[model samples]
Target: MNVAFDKPSPWQRIQPVFQGFDLPLVFIVAFLCGLGLVNMYSVGFDNGSRFFDQARNMLLAAGVLFLVAQVPPQRLMALAVPVYTVGVLLLVATALFGLTKKGATRWLNLGLVIQPSEVMKIAAPLMLAWWFQRREGQLRPLDFAVACGLLLVPVALVLKQPDLGTSLLVLSSGLYVIFFAGLNWRLILPVLLAGAIGITLIVSYQGDLCQPGVKWVGLHDYQKNRVCTLLDPTTDPLGKGFHIIQGMIAIGSGGVTGKGFMQGTQTHLEFIPERTTDFVFAAYSEEHGLVGNLLLMAGFLALIFRGLVIAAQAPTLFSRLLAGSLSLSFFTYAFVNMGMVSGILPVVGVPLPFISYGGTAMVTLGLALGMLMSIAKSRGLMQR
Candidate 1:
């Protein structure tokens, strides 16, 4: 009366690890990664191993995403405080004795050079989400104020390092969590209105404000130059304005159907600056045209939509807040990168996600996608 038992085959043993994964999300990421690879071959062929390096970066990121996805939402919540604390401490260390390249002190050497602010991109939102989750049934204005304090600490530190792009990203991540936590619109409208008013004033008086000796309050000289350059690139056609001007030309030359792959004159002629990194969008636009841009935008929109769906179905408050914030964080990255490249926003150090060639940014994106998948998997498990 004994029953025979058989050992599981390799595929059978590994099957459970793949279960509950969000397939739609995986498909979207693969689609974007495919675009990235195609783009690198065209724009980075002569950049000395950029194509292969990007390929390797993608593989590493995939590994990170897979490992992160295995952790449940509860364990993620437990790691939130420690991550945020260490991120803030690293920012402090960066300020005190960090390495500086091209006049910005944003990287620290902890046996390996690292940008601590990137850590805040995820930690800020996680910390805020954790705060709200702790007071889930008893939220108050004071709790939000405490959340703001937690957010602004890292933001101010990063700003002190004169890294406007990273600081804005960190601020937006925390703000998204706060908004999702039911902060009243009455408290948000005034800030938006004031920002609008400030922009109008800057636009109306650019001539006077952009003077050689003009010192804008709360902005570094380089930051002020970027804003002024955005207002009028013609003033410094060969200097500060060269990047925007070249970027616009490449994008405009792409037309409706593009110049075809690797046929981008502007890209091949080296007219586009940072053609594989921050300005990669311009190169992509030139080679792929408006249709390609549309498809790329649609893919990003799908990623955001799926993330929101996962957030809506998450089992806990922390999961919902973190998922929702991370989803919109992708929106922020795409919007800011595209806007800056299109000349609608000032040039910054932000890189286009998945398409841009940067090891650190790719890893950050992987961590975010992994968390989203983890939340999605948790929801599926609960349903059973």
Candidate 2:
């Protein structure tokens, strides 16, 4: 009575794969990718390669999402420590003896130029989720301290590399996990208050701090310039502030219904800097207008909502924590990128998630979506 089963037919094998996938999330991601393609084509008219590379990145990301979706949450948990350890060690290696370019040492050379900081974006949250999962019932203050230590090491290293953007991203990802794990409100409020106070101080002292040759404490000269320029872009109108000024002008010119498609004069006239990358949003807003912006926001909110639903349905603490953190981190990525492009926040080189033309960020987002799909898939497997 122990006869071996035969292989499933091609259709039979393919049917379950599609059925197991999270269709709503799939639709949301597809819509965003399609929007990205349109925007890339429109903004990258001067150089079509960005449009092509963005397409390639989307394909690579899809493959990653599909493959990762096949794995169960429990199995993914097993990878937490190993992946995090490797990612951090690589970061340390990057800090000690790594490649330097453009006055920043964030890259590594292993026969190829690679950025190690990018990997921590996912690894930090995964590792923290696993740690919290293990100490679910017996969590203590010291556990939070250890968790903070785990989160800070790579963040500190990335800071040493002086990559404010990636470090902030990584830090936010880890903090999402920490926040989701029942962290006390008392501990969170002080940080928020301090941040508010710091912003106020910076704005008030803008005139004094922004003077030429005045260096900021614990921040690079260029970094301080960015903050000061954000306070008042007219301070360096044609130089450091050009990008922000041009971006805001482009955004404001869009009006209610935008300039329509490729008719954005600012984009075509080359006023917006890095139209295909960090400042792509301005180009998008200039073309798509308010209605288009609302649609895009809706798409992101839909995706985030689905992610939170998946987190709620997750079967384990680790899965729940990871899913929630990934979801919020996705939100943070979009918020900061859009805020930066709109001249409301300092430009820290964060891409606009799926819309921005970059391989590493797309891959990271794919991995996160794949994890969400995997968690959803795990819930299905349990019900069966």
Using lDDT as the measure, the top candidate is 1
RMSD of each: 0.9, 1.9
Summing lDDT over every window of 10 consecutive residues in candidate 2, give the lowest-scoring window.
13-22
Q: RMSD to the native, candidate 2? A: 1.9
lDDT of 2: 0.92
Q: What is the lDDT of residue 37 in candidate 1?
A: 89
Best by TM-score: 1
Cand. 1 Cα-lDDT: 0.95
Candidate 1 C-alpha lDDT tens digits along 1-384:
999999889999999899999999999999999999899999996786999999999999999999999999899999999999999999999999999998989999989989999999999999999999999999989999999999999999999998999999999999999999999999999999999999999999999999999999999889999999999999999999999999999999999999999999999999999999999999999999999999999999999999999999999999999999999999999999999999999999899999999999999999999999999999999999
Off by over 4 Å in 2: 1-8
Q: Kindly report which residue stretches of model 1 are placed more than 4 angstroms away from their true locations once superposed.
A: none
